[model samples]
Target: MHKHSYIFITFLSIIGLLVSSCQQQTAQSDEPQQTATPKDSTEQLVLLLSPDQMKTIDLDTTSLKQTTIRKNMLLMGKVSVSPTHLTSLSSVVGGHIKTLHIIPGQRFSKGQVLATIADMQVIQLQQDYLTAKADWTSVKENFERQQTLNAQQATSDKNLQLARAEFQKLNATVHALEQKLRLLHIDPTTLQADNIRQTIQIYAPFSGTVNKVFVNTGQYVTPTDIICELIDPRGFILQLNTFEKNLPGLQNGQKIAAYTNDNPKAKSTATIINRVSSLDDDGAGIIYATLDQPNPTWVTGTYVNADVAVNNYIVNSLPQRSVVSFENKQYVFVKTGESSFQLHAVDIGESSDGRVEIRNPAQLADMPIVQKGAYDLLMAMKNKPEE
Candidate 1:
């Protein structure tokens, strides 16, 4: 009986051990399981300064503004004269140049005598005209006499016909000579035996500055030979080589300002007259602009710089000093508290006319931005001790 009591006690001890084990398991489950505690990511860079510190830093802040910025498209080009403005004069007849009253770079008036050519052919033409005119009178008198004789039945019809033929032939010869003399710039009615001239004076067709001289005194020339070239400066233009991307912002009649490297302040005004797509290479085209009131000092092939206003837009912006650079990024200080600011990163667009475009303005949340002395805040943030 004592041995049986010992076995029952042992079973009771084992049962008590199982109950404690179950209770411990239940307590372990009931207690909160250990999990990774989430790291704090709510903190940001903030600068806190006293009122005197702000004043000492020369810090200024203002609200974002809608600014109208005028952008310009720059072009490199050269000044040149239009093709229509250049004129070339040639000789009418082949002859030796007698005298040249003009030289290259000299200005001349209209109807001015440019040169004279002495030609034997012109003299022979005049002599033939006088001879034909003199023979015409005798032929006419003989024809009249033959007509009177034919009426009196003293001359045959054949004789009268022969006389009439001679008269018509002589008349035709005289008329032909008159026309030939006129083509030589000689007046037919004004020409007489005593007033015949062997030289023809070439007159200026238009007034302009001589650009090139091809012939000198006593040099023989042909009708196809060019005597000299003239240019009218009033038809000057600016030509630019522009890429295809620039076409969208350009059009005819747009005004542009042009200047040279020698003098930038002396700007020349011009208006776009045409755009040519021919001979386009590498997606480039030619743009032509008429220069307004071109300076007398400027000549063709002058290197010019042109500025065309384009892509005007009204965008949210701030002063250039308002934005600061940090870690190869752009930042602006946003006022979050009376004396505290948060460094806010922003996307920027074009910068011009002392203003910079705020591309991601929505991120600002209508916060006031630190202007004028934002760099000071950057310095302060850099020097601040870690929390």
Candidate 2:
């Protein structure tokens, strides 16, 4: 009986010890661990700020609200001159450039002399014209005399016929030479041996700024060579490349807002003049638009951003300053709790009147956003915690 009681007492003691050990472990597990593991980088970004810091930054919150906004297709393009407004200048006849009055960026009007070319061919052409005129006059006089003789029966029929043929031949030569002289801008009626010129002037066919000069003074150029390039700034148009799928949304006479990448505040309005139906190798289509009011300051080849209206509807939006851009992704802060904000990635659209349109409105509906101090929250969440 004594052995039995001893064994039973020992078993009871062991059970009490086991229960005590388990209770100790339960207490330890219930307490917070000293070392906390950091979350994965792709997980939700969070920021914890002190009350004083939040007050100092004057953190403000705004809720999502519905407002009328236009759906716009953001397009990237460049300024281009119309084909008809641009031209390449060249001489009709080959010659040595005697003088050049055109310099890069110089503006010239139609019929203005751009340069002068000198060659012996021009003088020779004038001389031939004078000689032909003299010969024609002599032959014509002889033909008249023969006609009178034929009527009087004083000359043989063969002689009269020969004189007539010779006169006709000389007349044709005179007419051909006269036209040649006119082509060189020489008036055949006023041209004489002493007054013939060895140079021909090149005139501007239209008014525009000289963009480039190929030939310098005293250089020989052929008719096919390009003398210079000219462009009219007034004919500047905006050219944009869009996908072939967007063709149905584009049309003639549609309004477009254009601005350069360097200066977004300096915006200009334009109207769609054309939309090419053909698709390029990449399935891209070209859009051409004319400036509503042309400006001389708009230079050709300048990169521009255009907002083409696609549709209009009510959207939730926020102030431009409420959003932050980091790592090429746009973000905004949502006030999850007092002194705590959650960073959320958002897809944004066109901005106007200091407000930006949010593409995903339902995600942020009825939620308070960090409007005033969003950047401060972004820095706190993005930066690593201090040691």
Candidate 3:
């Protein structure tokens, strides 16, 4: 009985230890677990307000002032030669080209001999004139004798009158022949000195350079045949063709500035001397403008740009970026009330550099316009409005 009691006490002690360990494990299992909450998802998205939105949200109505507007017209044109300044040279009569005294690009003074003509017709005319002159001299002597005889009653009045009439007729014929020789370009003084043996000489009508030469030695030439083209490079005029729609703004004496890519440093000013009344075959308008300034760098047939200043008028203007094109129409984001933007359609005018003229200024007087980030604002506005 004592051995059994001892073994039972030891088993009771082991059971008590097992029960305390289980109580401690249950307390650990029932303890509250600490879990971290996820961060707010709303903080990850950043709302970016575009320039249009900012203008609508932050525009100050009290500080806005009325803007002065200026209207201008822009036109594109090309440089050309004035038709009035261009000239063509041709022979006055038919003949064989004896010599070419001047070559292309050579300068000549007015009345300078360009070439000589060995014309058989001119030679025959000269011969006839000489013979007529000799006959006229003899006839004048006879007429004087006949008049003297008539006064003395040594010859009949009829014979004396006949001699005098013949003499006068011969004299008139000789004078006519002299004029004809002069028209033929024969120098009367030279002809008289050399007994009319010199070949006819062709002279330039104006002082200019020979731009073209058509005849060589021993070539046949006529009045219709072109001998050369003369141009006075010293007095050059620039011709420009402009659009017809811009014709109303263009007037005589309007100033224009011109330049070329090759000669950017050199600038020339021209005046609108004339405008073409006709339109091109395509129905586009055209105007002819001229510049009197001499430009050696400007060659005929060379194309150049011209800037013509049209009259200026008042207009409302804004930064070019403020305007956006949508569906072939232009619009600007304007402040409607507070922190909100609305798209407003606007008519655009002349634009240059970074500014554009607005046609209707009254519509924008009380509204805030988006000057920066306008395009971004437009893209954002295209989305559904926040509920």
How well is each residue in 190-282 modelled by candidate 1, as lDDT tens digits?
Answer: 888899998988877666677888999999989899998877778889988788766767888999999998899999899999976564658
Candidate 2, 1-387: lDDT as tens digits: 999999999999999999999999999999987988996884547777887777777788897776655567888899999988888888778899999999998878888999999988888888888988988888999999999999999999999999999999889999988887776678899988889888998888777789899999999999899999999777889989899756766788999999977778888999999887689799998889988877666678888999888654456789888899978999888898888877888999777667888888888888889898888777766674643
- Model 2 lDDT, full chain set: 0.85
Task: By TM-score, rank the candidates, best first.
Answer: 3, 2, 1
Candidate 2 Cα misplacement greater than 4 A, ranges? 1-75, 144-165, 232-235, 253-271, 279-284, 290-294, 305-387
The 10 consecutive residues of candidate 2 with the worst lDDT sum are 378-387
Give the winner by TM-score.
3
Between candidates 1 and 2, the TM-score winner: 2
TM-score of each: 0.56, 0.58, 0.60
Whole-model Cα lDDT of every candidate shown, in order: 0.85, 0.85, 0.71
* Model 3 residue 247 lDDT score: 65
Candidate 1's clash total is: 0
Better of 2 and 3 by lDDT: 2
Pitting candidate 2 against candidate 3, the one with the higher TM-score is: 3
Q: Using alpha carbons, what is the TM-score of model 3?
A: 0.60
